[model samples]
Target chain A: MAEASSPGAPPAGASRGFGRLTIEVRRSVSPQLRIGALAGAIAIGLTISAIALVLAGVPASDLAQEFIVATLFDPTNLKAVFVQAAPLVLVGLSAAMAFRVRFWNLGIEGQMIFGGVGATAVSLAHAGPDSTRLVAMFVAAMLAGAAWAAIPAALKLLMNVNEIISTLLLNYVASDILLHLLYGVWKDQDGFPHSLKYSASELIPDILPGANGGLVIAAAAAALLVVVTARSRAGVYMRFVSASPSVAEALGVPVRPLVFSTVLLSGALAAVAGFVVASSQEGRLTQSFYQGYGVSGVLIGFLARNNPFAAAIVGVLMATLVIAGQNLQVFYGIPQSMVQLIQAVIVMCVAASDFLTVHRLHWAR
Target chain B: MSLPTKAVALAAASAVAWSSVALTASALADVFKIDGPPKVAIILFGPKNDGGWSQAFEEARPELEKIIGAKIPVVEKVPEDSSAITPPAERFIQRGYNVIIGTAFGYSDTFKKLSEEHPKVAFLDASGITNGPNLESFYGRTYESQYLCGMAAAAASKTGKLGFVAANPLPVVNWTINAYEMGAKAINPDATLTVVFTGAWNDPVKERAATTALIDQGADVIGQHVDTPTPQIVAQERGVYGTGHHRDLAEFAPKATQCSSVWTWAKFLGPTLESIKAGTWAPSPYGAFPGIKQGGTDIACCGSAVSEDNKKKILAARQDIIDGKNAIFVGPLADRDGKERIAAGATLSDADLWKMDWFIPGVISQK
Candidate 1:
């Protein structure tokens, strides 16, 4: 109670003065220095991208223009990036949630695939243009995703199985299952080894005229996550567990259930992302679908420092890089693999800068 | 709480969900099956919307379906990767497909294996070398059409230089380059043809870059084997003349690019399907030389930029090739190493033509 009312203990003017001083201090840091740092990071990323392009026999000038068009200039390309980023943000949020409880739910990809499969099954079963059916399909998708995640969570809790290996292994199994559905029983009777076209009844209706509605749902989920983390008892307990598990135990926090629930939530969220992509864009599940959303989500979560809002921005940026890469391929003679190199460079720079945030850079000489 | 109890509940719920989904799909299929015609499958390497080889296949699908009186099931944008192709082919075979067509050169091995495994199913592969009792390989002689385009390029060029932009330096592509050079030299003995290989089958950007570089180097006329409108667009922008390969690109840059070596796949597909339906699909390595007479290879309508005299010359050359007055591959053919590949005044055998891997004189290797 005293901690909550600490603002009253300090005079209002003093508190206001402190806040003003903090802002002033931040402002005093040269804007040029900040811009320079960002520019340096971008330059390093471009250098790596350029090297890859040259090796791939594409000219560097073409690759540079592609980066510009993808990130800042083209509205259509920018929208494509945001649409791609939406799913990654959800998956990143899921990972961040699990990380908060020190539970590594790496099987987010498998869970998402299972979720898509479940949603697809529901859509196939209830073929109609009813909103209720769509809602039911989404719910089933979430449940299926949660159930897939729960397997690893339960194994970690009860059988002492390491989640990293289990989750990674499950990805292959899930992929095989998807292949089986596409090639075996669910094969399109029209002779192609592809699933039948999903009807309008199965689709998640668009949020706006152009953008996917899933982005709105993902943003809401992120906002809710932030509010829960900042304002709720469960959120506080999660933070406590993350900081010191022993201390949380002493404070009578139920560690096992917390870990289980958090991981489950993470898996279910990842699943929803998969559900969105499969239902919204593809309308049918393919073996190569969900191309690397899970792994990319892990990178996004790291870049954002597990901040849900920041993860959304980072995911959008990553998506922009991809679209821009394709544009570069179309407009210029730049290879698409250059985008992968840029992503790798960004990840490295972000990781390096994270160290700089905590420690000063020094030269021994 | 307990493991057994949780497992039981999970199994029960999953079973319920699975059964419900199965029942729904079956019911929907039953209702739709009676109304819709039986579906035929068309598996291709790229997207139907890509406006290239896959698009060509897609265009031919509806026509084939119309002839067969069946609803065609098309799997577009399928990857050419081995891991994707093998399983998908097996699945099609298992699903009792009447005819399975693979429209890529890479699917040769897979189709051969599948055809051997499923003898009853007829396999048709485009640009593939696979042949079996139930499988047939079909491809057109693109070099003959390219030769006619080459004559037009040479006759129309202000500069004595012509360019050929190819996807790869493979035998099939090399043959076009060789024929183009031979035809050009036949029209203007001083003409030199520069050839640049982009090392990709569908990269538009590289094709554009190669075209631009050649144009800058004073090559007034160009031809491309790449599958995109980049070359045509590039030529239009630079106020130069170019010829199209594969499908018609006159719509892409109608003013700048005059005439195209159009490859109509329907000519081969119609006969092959008829043969398949009649149970006479043999393991014949059939190569069609569909020139102007067959309408498989024809000079597209020339743009306004092309002069009347140049158009007449192109048409005359087309007639000469169709009437057998001019032989594109009649050799006196020599390899890059100066070895006599085709003896003087002797026509090359089919086996020799299929395994052509050398560049002719005046054609530069960009590898």
Candidate 2:
């Protein structure tokens, strides 16, 4: 674990020059046990999911075999995992960057949805199709996502509202607004709650036909964030703000501005994910445009411990588990609810691992 | 079977035969055929007991199993994405399941691709648009049955004002709403249908809200084109009359469901599977569009709230539909915009019916 310091600036306002006594973290004596604990916790969680499924009537043996096949055997299935991972990587990058500064931006889903709206609106505006349309759509989508992300940021700073609650609840508002438009203003004459299909010139061309070409953006974000977060001054200041807010304030770090930047960038990436998905195969925005990508991004971020690059890797792995695990429902008669249960359990394990991997508690003064 | 049940079953059987009357195509020189024992597998787009669209298939699985003389395996919650649809389909094929049944419009493209890739497997998708030599898409003419339910709604209504809760305004749902209005007019000339599209297939909360909103706005009877019996359930809670889609909503809200446009997949899928097994299966190029006479959708009619006389009239109207004595989207029709759509002597084509975006007179909707 990285030690906390006033990397951003000099400690500004400590009249006594000595701050109040505080507890500090040291590396766990048995640091090696942390891996074992995390792995064990994950195993237990998955085991519980399996046991519940078996009790619900799925054969235990078949479940085991399916997991093996899902994880290793089928090359085609592995490719699909990454295909689904495309949006997750972008959204996860968004979440990872926010988490680095302790912004807790749970509104990634809504931000992504707004992104889709912006892109779709731009596409519908007859922006002359293809590259022109793609560029405009991407810009509009990023701006829309940033705008939505800023809402919660403003609320947090002005009203002292908890972002977790505001961002989570706002997901419903965002979806409802989408529904309103789908059913009302933006509705196509086709009667389905979807937008008009993008003309060939309106869609972003794919780098590879099956793989979403827009994932290049996600990869770029990962690479760029790896630098900005680890090698930049803002990155060091962000660590202080996240580790100790009082320390960051005393160090003359503008916490609100930093938080604003974190959430804004996070929102833009999530919106990029929304654009990639809408343009991927759907060709048009449909009712299920969200497709759990936003929440999955949060999961990937936590699993990757706020590292943008790791978030991209974890995104693909998580997508693999989801894509392969869903088949268990089809082949083995396990319910979709069970798959969701397994995910919930895995997230809990990840959260626990994050705790165990950082910040040791001490009692002696 | 009792007389009504037997009559329905007979009509259902004949409907399948009559529906395929126009469908006469030969398979490609190299086409897939079932081996020794016909093994069947089904892929569902949602949970088995979704209480609507998917449930209709599950409800008829036993009959399908019986007719084919084989046990069928079913997988649920398969998404519309190609990757999600492909793996389970391949797994079933690898396990020696020769015939695959899918239930989703999203499955159309993937089903077509899979049909081409695996020339040995026969694919049947409900509501799918894409088709290959090995794949055939089919959907029932729900409007034909929904029209009858609309009649029931009108007959049950204290006021001539009715409300419709719909999932999207697509052609299939549009035809149903139009027919529903027509049917309502058949009972009461002045009856009006006010439709509220909930913009989803399975969101019960939205359905309930739509239903309640309609009821609040002087709609004595509610008709639903959305999945889930939520509209019917809401109708029952509010002590109002309602009609249902996909399956018999009477099972969910007995007192409220006056009529239901129900899928008789067993009666249809059974014979279709047999045709496939006999090596005479001809996948239609434009897809199979069947009505009451062809066993796509039929009416589960007349709750106690509807008089016996109305029930008899509803049954008679159904018989008329099954015999092709009437055409719903026929000539002399004008959209609400007062533009002539079909000539007096002509009828709407399937393609035209699917792209229907206009409303007829007396039908008010957000679309």
Candidate 3:
């Protein structure tokens, strides 16, 4: 209310010179600092969240210490954080690949569900050598994921449909299909509600003896994605198209095929994440097996800016936060929902804080 | 371990004291001892006000606190994942909470790990499958109460078509469905129960939708195994009768809910906590499968809609359960598929009871 009418207006500036506020967007802002503002925003957000906890009668000292103990001080707890973050690595890559071409794929949930269904089907379909079964399951998951992703891509390419709505709504459809199978044909006669467990011969075992195999797969995938994005010609073409569609057109890039392929590839990566989760974490398909890992992966994509290496780091951090928040709620009486609220608040404030930090606010004299 | 062998003279008078049983010598041999006073905490699978399973646990807190002589801290909405379960359990142990009660089947594996990792802390989980030297998993024989609810429901229903919105078609859920049909048959031999499996425990939207579908299909009474009272609410809206689970759901559908299969957790937990305090808490070898007589569950019955004559019959049936004179799952019992499940004059074992996947004669579902 006590500010200048315009950021760069002399007439308004003159009228309210004695009592006015001025905010000017800086000519240039570094990307590094913009990212740094995310950290700053999160720090502020945590401080505010902690204050809220205090106001709600949660002992601040206990909550703080328990959080540190759960996330960092306890070595055993760290293993859990790592285990959870493994599948996110691939899902994050999925979203990152799509974001490279500005494809807002909200249908990763559907892709993951089909990916799980595909692998489950192959495992149940027949018996084979362990390696052969693993490879078959992997390929099937990717094919299903890609096929599911193609629906929205086709919608966008053929009819210029908005992908956000189409992709998001498909998640429910996928859920219904999973329920149908669980309640119908796949229903274990031995266990009416739960589907039959996939045989051990077909499961993807851990690479290291007695260790979670998903972590090894995630690491390899991260390395491969890094090379593909940094050195591959397809990556270069996608970047060029992102930089300027007209230039990409002039340079003979097949725009439709390139976009379609990117979307397919994006879904294939996410499907792998689903496979990892089903094999390593759940070990069997249940009604609630597919949690919101896809949505979380999308958020990781945003925070990591579609960078594989950064996604790995951020995903692990988020896993720790989730694990730590459990201790906070259980031990210190903090609300379990606080963890989700703080995450959303930090993400929201990051953009505003980035802009604010880049611009200068002054009082007109 | 203290009870008279003789059946109580007055059935209705013993209604509040439904199932007071004399503990066997094996149960009296309580082996474990707590390090100090009982500092209890509860880890709930859903929000405290979830209107069902979790709320029943929360509601028992006051009685539990009184029995244990300490305030109990509770953490709600803890997920079933290991990562989500471990930290809170450990935190409770770290904070000197020697007794931890969990409410979820999903917590089975995690509770087993924690029970071993922290030998000094006693861990208990409802509907969980795992146990150790210091851990005991407990679940109720819910069919007993559901049977009572069925009687009340049949009494209230003008039309005998009862519909059920079930969660998972698991054994625990299945038992209730079968026993309900049996009880309904006891009231009116032609009464048939139709079932719809929603496949989730706590999805209200699905529960309500299923309830509406059931009511639309000429079901005048609704039965449920899902974790919400949405079915009862829907029945109330449609002017039909319904039975509730977990708590006295008549609180939600005062006019519609005639009875509820309620968890009398405090009746089981209070004495068990006292045993823990007295340094004689022997965990069950095969988990605590407490029946009506041992205080795992009971029915909240006889709403305004239930007639006095029917209420008398319900009370008599309930007394038979308490006196161990009636065995619900005893044969000659054959499944709907005409397969003999139990031999004539024989009772089903606990293992077989937990695997009751088949329906009885009058229960109709999509199969």
Candidate 4:
């Protein structure tokens, strides 16, 4: 195991200002165990998934082929998976940011939906000869997403409300709003409960020939988050607050404001995911558009242990499973729901591995 | 031998023959009946109100119940995943449902396995390929109706180019596209058809995108095999003619969409259920020919967009099909590679039509 610091010298932060506290914190984790723990967890998770597939009646040969095909081989199928994963990656980062500070913002899905509705409303309202109206719609989507998230943030900061419950409950409210738009105001005049077709002027120009621009936005956000958390003073403060709220307060960190900002930022990022999905993927609001990306994002964040960069990778992997599962269905007649079972297994394995990494195991037998 | 002894022997032999016949008849009539009303279970892959395949099956449930005088229990929005299908089916079978209907193609394998395990339960699968002593598969001849829609499109088109937006390029989908092309060519020999596969069953955006691309490519008349109204909406927006599949969609684009191939599943379900009740349910692998004559596959009420002349032509084409004067997959056919599928002037057999997997001459595959 890698030592916490050189034996002859005091911990770097200890001499600088924090004293013994920095040394104690540095000594807790060994570098060698981190990689091993992650690998072991993943292996266990895959084994569980394989067993579930067997119980589900999928032949072992077919399951193996599905995993291989999902990881590689088919680009069109792979593209669909990436498209599915893109939203989750963004929302997962949002959850990770708040989670690092021990703040639970379960309302990421609601924020995303509101953002989508906001963008759709703006696009529909101002659709015409002017191109600038499209830009306005994008801005409106982001603002609405942030505003929707801010409500819970305000509630948590002022009234000391449990954000987890409030945010989770808001998901239904946001979904109801979406239904209202589809069924009432923006409903297609054809009598079907779908929104009217979005005009060409309403769509955002694709960043790549075939890719959605929103994917680029998500990537940029992930990169920015990594840099901020790794190099900025605010990140250190957030870590301090997360580790010990009392110590953070004694060190003069504005705990309440910091919490409020993190929650708000988290919501805004999640909202962007929703906005992109609505504006680019479906164009018009339909009840089936969300496809559970919000919940999947939370799962990915948990698997990544609240690391934004890691969440992105896990999100992509999750999406790959979906695409691969569908392909397997087409090729081997396997059910696509196998993807969900695989996801559950991976999450459990990762969680268990993390536990083992943190604690020493004893053999009783 | 004594006369009294001989008469006794004759009477005993007569009794044995009569009893044998009676036993065989009773064995043939053997049916598993439970106390109270007959329980029927319906499993669906999506919501009952999806306005698609599942919805169509759900609509027939009430009519079926009314016919049988029994309350039917439907399991709606069931996952297509095999893992979910088996457990739910086992539970339903344990509860003693006499009949189970699976309404999706993916459920065929699971239903087949379960049917074997519970031989007393009659299994009816829609859009699946399974047939056993207790399991039967049912599908309507949807391609025949799609051909009529094609005639309407060919007559209504101003550009002489027709478009088909398909969910996937499977053999089932190929039947509809081929029928449309054949019908269009019968009406207007110069007509050209273009088909695009969106690689999904229920993505509205992809469907719309494919429709728009087809319209931009100078396709003046459009038809779609998707489960949503997006195609009709797109056709209406582009001011072109359109046709629908699986259900009536004229209401979605009354101005641009004129007709649809509506499925009437109740036509077969009512008779099939009666047969089951009478203890005469036998596995019949023979496919049902649901043409206009049977009221199973119907051309929905045409919208005002269809002209009287076009309607007359469509009706004439339909009559020809009904009278067996026209065969959609009639041979003398050549695939795209110019290799003869059937020798020139040779008609295709029923087996040939059922297993068709190639594109005809003049059609381009986007693979």
Candidate 5:
């Protein structure tokens, strides 16, 4: 409560001066206020991004054409957006699920890497018939991701190792292992540092003429997540664990198994993201396919406030930004750093809005 | 806690809209032809001012524009992924671009596919392996220029121990390491070259650590095949001599850089575009490998550290390579392991060059 005091407020045990502003923690925040705060943050983020981009010499008309018409309306680019968004949706849901259990799953990229490797392994080994190869690859990817996620979860449970550090450091280990395979055994016939391209039958088939299978898979996953969170007994248990672990433990919730399982599910979902990314977008297990996704997952989780439904929306928005950013670069010759900066601004602004949800500023005497 | 039926509907709408996109990509051209006036564009694999590989193309754009007599716009930071490469490329094509230059090995497959999809557009990629009827991949024989830089490094070295930083143990990188050693040996017979591969192209932190480690190991000069000028920058800070790759490193580290293996894409690309405009272009099925003779690459030679006599020798060697009187990889060559890599009275083939995994004597590396 003392920490919530504003900068100009008097220190503890002193008389507060008139017109001195102070912040107080709210007992509960109304949903309407939460929505209003989010809307305000979005407005600020968009306005700032617009001003920055305009200052950088992008015309307002062109910006609209690029972001709205080109990214959202153009058939080819919209398809590309769908392809890009699929992995983002899965990773976003995964991050949200882990965050619900109060577990910071920074190892999203590592699990993704293992997932891609496992899928590629299935394809390379011809593990199943041509018709069933894609399914086999998907299964392998999920298992691999879960296995990778188990490491950090077990360490956190057994030795109380800080999951944040372990998960973050494991990203490098995953990349190195990926490189090791690419540069060694998995190198293509041309000696490039990428695995052989998957056979067409092993790749994600387009559900519609141009609609990739990955998007459907991602949408279904998001829907499944919504169901699991709202309808399942495990969902209620998870809410208890999220509110307060010790309290939940005293209330007879199986905290350890719940946390572990949630983390594993998160890993599996992230791995599915990798599978889609490789199969649908890259067409092969490439070194950099998993790049930038770990941060994107976390950003989506933050922006969506760990809600699966909101995550799907945020994923589409981010995918739109990516496509539009590419258009801006292609047309205006703006640097990628500027595009990334706009994304950072939006994320930072949205994240800052969290402060308003728990506290209110008031003038005190 | 609410159902996301609205999100599912949105996804379904987006998916339904996708069906409007036609999947009718076919290669119908027997000979590549532009339907309108030549319009050229470039797709860069990194930022325009990345201080290395991509910057070389950015620097070449104006010169290429002059040769083609039209503005050659560029899109930078297009990654090697198909999804990333496609949108910019398709947009350029839609806006009537007839010629597209790509700068990355990763752009190969996409370029090939795009070339087939749009036969009227001529495609070219640097360091790419793929080539087709409407597509050609070209790369400078960097080993030739690096050889000269190696001589310069050896000349500036007080310790007779030189270091090299590279991205990968791939043939392209390994060839540079070998050529650098060969060039160093030409000046100082016993000058040994130690190499460190950072496993990434543009990682400055790793490049800096590798450079510092080499300098600490008594290396007086450094050479690099990595994309960044970090090795040269580190050398300058450490008061050691270095040779640069991609672009002239003297721009970043004037004091310590003895010479730089610089890409002369303008010289190669200008003529290629001219031929392309004249409808006389015939892309090689095996891709183009230009050397100093054709100006694919050359050296920005002789910093203050290199003696005038050594500078003369380096220039003379460059001239010999240009005149086809000398080959960097020739007969009597043996690997560091004392295994014969080149037989007597023979020269290394281009195919062998691309598959080069063995290093010549006096070249040391972890690989």
Candidate 6:
């Protein structure tokens, strides 16, 4: 539905760029077109990454093997991808949940650290029976994460302090606390800067012979999130809040409580990620385990448009890229920085495509 | 379970474990043997050209290749996390590589687990703490070379005040600090060595700030035990002298670097790899601690500032250390608090060196 003042000529109110071109905000986009645009964006990203890798001296065949065959067809490599993806999926969901309510939640790493510390504390204390130890650790991790997250959320709500600054700064405080424990009280018998390894009972069990339980837990969380965000009454309220906070409040939605609860839930999810990494990947509370995941979580949420299922897919895709990056470095001696550069290029390309969904370019006479 | 109950149970389990261990003592000393021709692959914790610790290993790669007569490929910037370490290491093993070299203390646990899972593969880690029959963790007696660098720093200083930038108060780092102080005092009796811990291995910003602060406090020469050459670069910028660590800082600050305590990993690893190939490799139970004589670490000494006489003196001291005539941590050592550390006529043991937490006289630092 073009609004033109004159039939064969440009309107007086037309944008003056090139005296003929105009950008029109789309009132609605068909689901098919939206999917097509997203698919095209992802395709462009992959093509760009593939070309960059080839130019970086990775043979095209090897690139395919590393990116697809090794990661997907090979069972062990696939397991490794899932092992990495589980934590990423939780972190992505954590970021997505808070971001949907207009909160940055940059303190995901900090919350994760607190979660790990809390789990380690439970193990060290031997707080429950063997059957209930894991449950206790999980609950403690979520609570710790929520408590850490509460600081920035409260500051934003009560004192009107910027959440971005508070959340980002709290990461440093959490890091110092982690180091203090690792270097001082919680150090292992070997005097290393890491907590003691957890007992067998403290570790996340394998769901099957070779399948990691953390992956199952993460998938369940994602599925639950899909249901909650799509079907629940709170989900409807959340959508209203996201659309327009003032309007939603005027229409009787409890905006503050919704935002506060969402942020706390986000923190709890991130903490679960930390617990998964510690229990499933590292096998102990270790320094530097939480590194780089915050950025990955935010990026995954953005790419998925804060949709839980899409975030899960993007998280796995990200894990695949990480494994492939390691392979490129191991096989071709490409520096990690180059791999990071390729990833940045792909993310930028996909992000630029978001513009296509929001507006349409019109050719005016 | 309750805490006390858990502790009692743990103690009982350990006592039983120890008796079983004693019963199986004969099996404990079994020598590790490689099954076939050795294929070496290295994992670096930082970039290959990181200018310090990681670069030291990368520079040694060519020498190792020549010794093994095979290419030694490396994966750089691998994090300390097991998830990051395991895939590349497993891939290397899958590809038929038998020998894996890890270059971080953080790699200790993963390397230990990998060594157990693949008993035929030999694993060697630098600055690591875990060792098994098929795994050996090794570190240099860095204090030996740092002592020599100290002499050079003292010789170069206009005033008798020296400052050191260190990573942490870990025993290995502390030993270097004490040795540097001893070496400086040997050159200038009244030299007071002040230390500032950056609490980081490779933060150049912190290193620069610490260097400037020390220089402002009348330290004419600066020494560093941190990973970067930032201290040396800052010394050059501020028109002062500094000693280096990991690699030759003269590469970065040619004019200001009086001496550098550099890792000679190739000199140490070449023979170790040869022994592994020859099936005579017996990894130490307590990890390898090679000194300058065994080529773990040595110094690049004497910038233009050091007088010829001082250079000769430093070289003679180096020769004495190599000949086992001069042990830096030998008896009559005392902490700055007037407390005796090493009693007279007795040398500091390797275990004691590793647990060293107190400073010798002339060394100052924060609590």
Which of the two candidates, 3 or 5, achieves a greater DockQ against the reference? 5
Provide DockQ values for all models, in the order shown. 0.03, 0.25, 0.35, 0.02, 0.54, 0.58
Score each candidate by Cα lDDT: 0.70, 0.81, 0.80, 0.72, 0.88, 0.89
Docking class of 3: acceptable
Model 4 residue A154 lDDT?
Answer: 89
Fnat across every predicted model, in order: 0.00, 0.26, 0.40, 0.00, 0.55, 0.62
Model 6, span A280-342: residue lDDT tens: 888899888899889889999998889899899889888887887777777788888988987
- lDDT of candidate 2 over A125-204, digit per residue (tens): 87664658888888999999999999998999899899999999998899988888886778776555568877876665
- For all predictions in the order shown, the interface RMSD in Å is 14.7, 3.1, 2.6, 14.2, 1.6, 1.2
Task: Indicate which candidate wins on lDDT.
Answer: 6
How far out, in Å, is residue B69 in model 6?
1.7
Task: Give the Å shift of residue B71 in candidate 6.
Answer: 1.4
User: What is candidate 4's lDDT per residue for A1-365, written digit by digit as tens?
Assistant: 12333355433334334334222223345747866888788788778888877887778887666676544554444445556666878988988988887788788888888777877887677654467766776677778888888888888889988988888898878887777676567866644345665677675566875455766777888999998888998888888888998899999998888888888788778877876676666556655556566677778788888888888887777766655554444334334456556767787877877766665432211
**B1-367: candidate 5 lDDT, tens digit per residue:** 1345575465456434432322233432334556666799999998898998999898988888888788887888888877788888988887778899999898887798788677668899999999976789999999999999999999999889999999989999989999998899899999999999999998999999999999999999999999999999999999899999988899999999999999999999988888888887878888999999897999999899999999999999999999998888998888989999999999999999998888888888896
Rank by TM-score, descending? 6, 5, 3, 2, 4, 1
Candidate ordering by lDDT (highest first): 6, 5, 2, 3, 4, 1
lDDT of 2 by residue, B164-228 (tens): 99987778888899999999999899999999987678888898889899999999899998888
After superposition of all CA atoms, the RMSD between model 1 and the true structure is 19.6
| Residue B362, candidate 5: alpha-carbon lDDT | 88
Model 2 clash pairs are A129-A201, A130-A201, A191-B169, A191-B170, B15-B293, B15-B294
Q: TM-score of chain B, candidate 5?
A: 0.91
Candidates 1 and 2 compared by lDDT, better number: 2
Residue A89 lDDT in candidate 1: 84
- Candidate 5: which pairs clash? none
Question: DockQ: which is higher, 2 or 3?
Answer: 3
Query: Which residue runs of candidate 2 sit more than 4 Å off their true CA positions?
Result: A1-34, A53-63, A117-144, A154-220, A245-247, A281-284, A354-365, B1-38
| Backbone clashes, each candidate | 0, 6, 1, 0, 0, 0
Alpha-carbon error at A258 in model 2, in Å?
Answer: 2.4
In terms of DockQ, the best-performing candidate is 6
lDDT of 4 by residue, B1-367 (tens): 5884685476456445534654676452333332344577777777677777778887888899998887676666655433335544554564567788888765655677676566567888887666665677777777788888887888888777988899865567777888888777777887777999876678789999999999999998888888887888899999988998777887678788878888787877777788787767765654344556665676774667667987888888788878878767766777778778877656666556656667775455585
